[model samples]
Target: MTEPSTMLAIDPAAPGGPEVLVPVERPVPTPEPGEVLVRVRAAGVNRPDVLQRMGLYPMPPNAPTIMGLEIAGEIVAVGQGVARPEVGDKVCALLAGGGYAQYAAVPAGQCLPIPQGLSFVEAASLPETYFTVWSNLFERAFATEGDTVLVHGGTSGIGVTAILLAKAFGLRVIVTCGSDEKCAAARALGADVAINYNAGDFAELAREANGGRGVDVVLDMVGGDYVPKNIALLADEGRHVSIAFQRGPRADLDLSQVMRKRLILSGSMLRPRTVAYKSALADSLVRDVWPLFAQGKLRAIIDSTFPLADAAEAHRRMEAGEHVGKIVLEVP
Candidate 1:
């Protein structure tokens, strides 16, 4: 079973639209020290991939230029200093980049074993959003049992994962969706409350849902004017974790609110973090969350999948905001 020297990938000719995500031939990455080469069966399509395609997302220094951030596949080769995940092990890994391809080289520690009975597509969908949600919503926000959280973009990958993780850990989650349909979807996924942002003021609705106390944590992706609104909804000593700013980066907020409430505002971009940090996160997920999946208490919710060559369509679906869960790309 010799690996191909070159693989089909979506490296992009230049920064542009979804059309730029065309498949092209690129040399398959060899596993570096402590890394493993995955024969990628599937890859997850993420917002950062779209940002990278448009040249909007800043590339981490010396990171791979390819447009994928997560992949699930089988280990075909291993690099020096690697142990445990030998050749032929199935894994899904959070990558620095280079996931939209037939093969990817990833640090062994970052490659989490696929949960029992999950397909490659399901496995692929886990890494990026799971890592992001666990780190920001659970770790950074310090959301514990019985706390309530306000999660924006209820149907988005990160939002869905937040809901599931919160439910698994006994947190009450209030999520904001763009439509009634999406809100219903979120409710079906165990969210304590789902508010359609277009319906009315989400902050008021979420506060009412939490018995007028507001949320202990806010997982915000929609930035800009929403920041102050989110801040207004926080309970005393609340934590706000920003994972994206789709609305815009700048925010006009009242500093007096921060002082009075002792709010903590924190944000993180997963790709820029060191391998050791991400690996530790992966380890944490394996220990704390993977068992839930294995026990059938949790499952990957996939909206759709595309062939590796149809990455453009995947991006378009993601951008359209019509999908309720993860959009994935399947490889040969």
Candidate 2:
């Protein structure tokens, strides 16, 4: 099959605000070897996408750059040596870039069949949050049954996914959200305890909720002022993983608490990792987690969906922080 001359995509004119994300036309990308061309139906709006737009996160080196991390669509064409998925198979993929487009070229190995009973919009929400949780919480942090896990930003996409998955795996979950309403939502989604970060100190609250014993794992995206508190809130041999530093990256803190508790601290950025790592993650998700989604034991929590042309509005909503779950852009 031949690629089309042009397709619709959202482009950042300059690193600034939502207005910078303007619609543009670009030539459809062809699938390279071991890749497949997908007709994008929807793309998830994540904080990383907003960071990329605001210059906090720079775009990967290229021109006519399109920014989106996850998409759900149909495979339209396959490149050399591809097998398994045929034309028109519905799939959701983890992409490095170019997801905010009419068509995207995705590594074939990173594409997963859309789970039963999920729409394109829902499927679009899975890759970034689910992959992050699966990789960090379960895979790297060594979270397991009977472990007590604490997740910050409890109402956010990552928080919700982590809460649900941990509960499903028989781990007690404690979470911190910005407001009581958000905490309620987190509890409804399976968190055993939801602390209002605006009203309480999360470190102290998590400790209180766990019967004086701190949680086994703490998944934190908020850094800076919360770092010392996070270290203080861990159980013996606990794990602390950071995926983002929304507050600030730099911290001046004492390490005695970490050593005293025998805690493990780690952080990861998914985008810059080698393709092989992502491919392996995708395979692991398919093998270990897809069954939960297929059985309806896990589901995507979508807060809103915007038209592809309204990508600017989507960014505005995300930046405002009212959304409780994943936001998506319908690409059509």
Candidate 3:
């Protein structure tokens, strides 16, 4: 079969809103060494994509300008040194960019076989949230079995994955969602307690739910005022990992509390990491987390899907904050 010279992809023409995500024909990217060219079937939309469209998260040096971070598809071609994912392999990969396209050239190290019993749409939803949650909650926070974790934005994609993974790993999970309905959804996903932030104080509720010892770990996306509160809710030697700052980046924290509690505060950005680093993360996921999917202990929670050209509408839905889980784009 002849490969197409050009493919349709969503590009942010300028820094602005969802309207900026325009479809246009672009040259197909050729995989470099240790990479594979994927015929994208589905892509996951994430909060960072929104920030990138708004010019808040500028493309890293040498990264593609396309908006998607994760994609599920088939390997159509491979670059030199790519051994495992040969042509015709079905995979879902975490990408630095360029996933919002008909095809994407991704580092083979970032690719993983689509889990058994999952569709391309569900596979697409896994990489970004799963990688982030795994890197932060388990790796950085060092959360282990029997630990209790408080996850903010419990109904969001990252939160849902964190809840499921934490529960699967034998940790007690508490969550905070914006509404009562979202709180209920979190509980159904295995959260031991779900705090409706609009109805109650999340820090207090988390502490109360954890026997007044506070949680052993916190996955916080909301910064600003949430920073101090998150710090307040951590038990001694607790870890706090920040992935995104939906509220605001700036925070005035009480260092005294951090010092007294011996808390660990850390965060990571996935896109800029070296391929070797991401490859290691992929290995960890396949070895430790993939089995959970086959056992029916882990699953993707999709809120909605849009056709490739209607990416702007998908972005609108994500920004509206009504969706409970991930928003996906189907590529033809």
lDDT of 2: 0.89
Cα lDDT tens digits for candidate 2, 255-314: 888888888999898887777888889999988888898787799899999999999999
Candidate 3 global Cα RMSD: 0.9
* Model 3 misplacement above 4 A: none
- Candidate 2 regions off by >4 Å? 1-3, 61-64
| C-alpha lDDT score of every prediction, in listed order | 0.93, 0.89, 0.93
Error of 1 at 131 (Å): 0.6
TM-score for each prediction? 0.98, 0.97, 0.98
lDDT of 1 at 231: 98
Worst 10 residues of 2 by lDDT: 56-65
Q: Residues 210-240, candidate 1, lDDT per residue (tens digit)?
A: 8879689999999999999999999899998
Give the lDDT of residue 107 in candidate 1: 91
Each candidate: RMSD: 0.9, 1.4, 0.9
